[model samples]
Target chain A: MRIEEHPILDFKRGREIYFYYNGKKIKAYEGETIAAALYAAGIKTLSKSLRLHRPRGFFCGIGKCSSCLMKVDGIPNVRTCITMVREGMVVEDNDMELPDKEYEGCELRKKAVDVVVVGGGPAGMNAAIEASKYARTLLIDENPRLGGQLIKQTHKFFGSRRQRAGTRGIEIAKELEREVMERGVEVLLNTSVIGYYKRSHHFLAAADKINRIVYEIEAKKIIFATGAQENMLVFEGNDLPGVYGAGGVQTLMNVYGVKPGNVGLIIGAGNVGLILAYQLLQAGVGVACIVEAMPKIGGYFVHAAKIRRCGIPIYTRHSIKRAYGDGKVEGAIIGELDENWNFVEGSEKDIKCDFICLAVGLTPSIRLIAQTGAEISFINEAGGWVALHNEYMETTKEGIYVAGDLANIEEASTAMIEGKIAGLHAAHSIKPIDDFERKIKEYMEELEIFRQGYFGERPKKAKEKILEGYYEKMGERRSS
Target chain B: MKRWEREGVAEIEDIRLPTKEQLQKGVAIIECIQEIPCNPCVDACPFNAISMENINALPIVDFEKCVGCGKCIEVCPGLAIFVVKAKGEKATVMLPYEFIPLPKEGQMVKAINREGKEICEAVVKKVRKGKTPVVTIELPAEYAMEARHIKVKAEE
Candidate 1:
């Protein structure tokens, strides 16, 4: 288990690293990525699967899935769970794979473009639209369709009209896509950026088709609008067939219209967890319980009361002890934690549940960006090792800029603004700076306004963080 | 509707149409029928029964002195207002029912608790719907104290 009292997460933190697996000296951090530093050490299958005992690694370590887990430094089967890095952390790997099969390589692409945007989601589309103003922009998406996570979002957004308040997220996504199309931005759906490298003039993007192909394109700039993935949790028997990430539940029910199960237990009390619980009710599915390890619900009070007045009880300070199942998830065992963060003896209670949805937290997908030799920093506050970029969203490498979740971890609204900033800056680099200073000021002003609301306040801090460097530059310029 | 305050509920009390002497002069009638966020009932009436000037404020009803004339309840979301007319030994209550499974006249159904739980059985003597599907149910005067919610049974 993870540490119990982290400075940032406090009592919600897992246990301190104590035990070691397979005589390997692995350390767990107070709030670091268990899969990340472990991957750096080449230890996969942190734990065994429930039924088939298949080895699982750091597949979607953003807490989106329960694939990466281990009996951390003791405390059986914790999700090395997208936690922070700490000192003297000991983690062990279980369910080891046979040492015979050769590992397969990730697919790479052959076609080249001037500017390649990673995602076709809302931020990606907006970035492509803005970048197309000056540079030849090519938008690439792994999905067959365009609209990213917003397509599964059915609830109305809560912001001003400029941010499209009172409009459904999917509608806003559609509007953004149409706007991008109107700007004549080229879109390449079902295209994934397998790898990244720094060229003399630009960056080379490798993608996979039938076979891996390298795109040696001399691009003026690159924007990474690759959005976030869902988070997951781990417990005994958590890898059962019926268990899924919160986003997986969303994709299954909201997107595919296929019912995940009749009764469900949602672990995590953040906005995503609460929203999914509400959506499940709307879809005529029964919510068994909303379990959270925190003392209070993590989402807004309004969202909590909405579920409460509807008579759904939220259990706080409770964590899953075990998941009871055979080939599929049939039930789950949850227990109350004491002040020391230890599961109380005899406190375990079993509930008949077929589906367990975990919405713990998200980690930025920055492996490809890291592969390009960009300066990567492991910021605990900003998800994981994101590429370092300046106020213009450009990285240390001149032509390559990062946007959306791949750069810094933030929500969709802020990602949209960052994408616009990257796009505008990329365009400014390629074409004449047409009202560039004025546009930047206007964009920053609008972003400031959007940052004033309740949810926007968090990103406002992140914006200040990004702008701190720019503020010094401006001060120096004024002095000169 | 005007509201009347009475002490000690749960007992049958004699009620009848008020004589001309009891009718207040020029009581400004306020109809809150919009189901939107509005608080004209508190401000327009010059009375202190309403408190919510904030958005989405539910109008507070003062039972002691409201002249039952069907006003604020008409303007509530989901049409949740009722003017209880206690005459002789019978009480008539105006309610809002918007679901497809409508309750019919003389239908017997269980009254629900505040948490949507069933509490007591109530017989609907009459069923009436106005412009907004407002159903007025007439029940025995004794039931006026026990019944707060309503639910219909499936047809046999």
Candidate 2:
């Protein structure tokens, strides 16, 4: 089920290895995740739901979702999607059983830095690269490797030359990764920021899951570029094993060279869904069709055209009613929606697809920022409740900044620009730089230019509202 | 509703069709109608034939200045640009192709239109390989405007 040849990407698989999945031997690669290897072997069901005992597979491949949690090496609740496979590794479906072994003491390490940027995606990587120039920066991410979601993106990006437009996202990630390493930014991969405590100094409690150590990091400025997580569609049998997030499918096929399924029914017509349809076709997987609830296509017309020319149908004003299968996704029933947003009766059509990909939308990962007592507000256009930040990308809380999808659910180009603004601003606050004002202005201009398109209208309004709220809050605080 | 909006297949009227003289000299036909934030085609044109009011503006090609070098074909993230040239009865249509098993030179293939319908037979004329390979196919001059893609006979 592994894609042997792809036109856009060349998957460099590691040495051949094997792992035990439920007492059955599964062939794997050295660098692949347990979930990837299992999926390639056609084992869709990774774990069962705790309450309903329903079969569950990996959703968001970046370890944001808990569907792929499995028992690995006698430890329960290990995220199989992010956990790398080893030689002769033992991986079992989550049996809802706690580990019988006693908890061992983990090594505690203390570190101090000028800036701490969370999430090593496009935003955090750029932030680290810029911040490290003026201060000692520490970039932390929960993934086993850097680049966050960029590693799986094989399509070329859109924007001006400054944003690396026309270059594939994978290449942009590599360039940023190289810059981060060359800038002397201390990177902590496979480390999750567990908690943020406000004591005499700002302390971030991070746990390095792979190394089995806890890091207490104190920094002058903190940037939460924690990115976003895919939103789930509330359709019947959504908890089924084959219902995966769009990003998860990309990780399986593009990143790990594993086919998600024989045929897929994508549930959204946004850019992600459109790009995914083309990518799936490139990977030799059949796309049943794209079902969009919106009256008009949500993604760019060109993206939709790309798939349409390839003979893929896009059904607008339609939605998946339910997915049905015995243990996993076998197919899905879609129905046309009326003007009232209700499914028209007698318009249902059953699509024969082994998997359903949900690209509905994404919500910012605001947990760690919320933990910092930052002001959070519900901005529908901003992709749900996000931490309010000013033009400099600094949140309501002093010395703390937010960037990428955490600030707003926009494209990677905007996220990189925001990261640069936040990184330079944070570094300037730590130690004033001479050309800080000029650099920030240039980045802001680039960001404004990027947001002038029709697709940028909603995000533009949302950001203005957030800025208004930020200023209002600042004024109230000053008066009080 | 326009077919492009409903089905993502641009109609003949949606774009500026090349004149016979322009087609004779060859020109890059920009099918991009949406105003998204992209301007690589403008920069990709060494002749400065492609211009945009802003980064978000739709690309406008000056057929008079364009030499149909096909530089913009690979740079366009949307793969919406194509080069068409007339040669009496048969014409060449160059487009961006990213799929595996690229059609070999001189191979006869099925010429596909915007609606994914096979219109006529074409022969692979040339292929400029890159991250996003651009392939040129020769087909009937009448179908030059319709054929946006190619389906290799061996693929089927």
The best candidate by lDDT is: 2
Tens digits of per-residue lDDT for model 1 on B24-119? 211112222212223334442234544543323334555435665554443332223455565556655555443335678778877642234455
Instruction: Compute the lDDT of residue A421 as modeled in candidate 2.
Output: 91
Which structure among the candidates has the greatest TM-score?
A: 2
Query: Per-residue CA lDDT of candidate 2, range B36-124, in tens?
Result: 99998988889999999999998889999999999999999999999999979989999999887899998888898888888999999
Q: Which of the CAPRI classes, incorrect, acceptable, medium or high, describes model 1? A: incorrect
* Candidate 1 interface RMSD value: 14.5
Which parts of model 1 are misplaced by more than 4 Å? A1-52, A55-114, A208-216, A453-457, A462-480, B1-156
Angstrom error of the Cα, residue A316, model 1: value is 1.5
TM-score of each: 0.62, 0.98
Q: What docking grade applies to model 2?
A: high
- Candidate 2 chain A weakest ten by summed lDDT: A95-104
Clashes of each: 45, 0
Worst 10 residues of 1 chain A by lDDT: A1-10
What tens-digit string does per-residue lDDT give for candidate 1 at A1-480? 112221111123334453244665665434335554454344434555678675444434333345665655443444553343456655555334442221145443355556778787767887898888777888877564677788667665543345554455667788988887888887765455656665565555544322323344446677777766655566887666566678656654554443567789888887788777866765656788878887766654434533543345577778888877666678999888788888989988787887788878677777666666666666555666667667777766566778877766666666777788888888887776768888877776766655554445555565455445444443432210
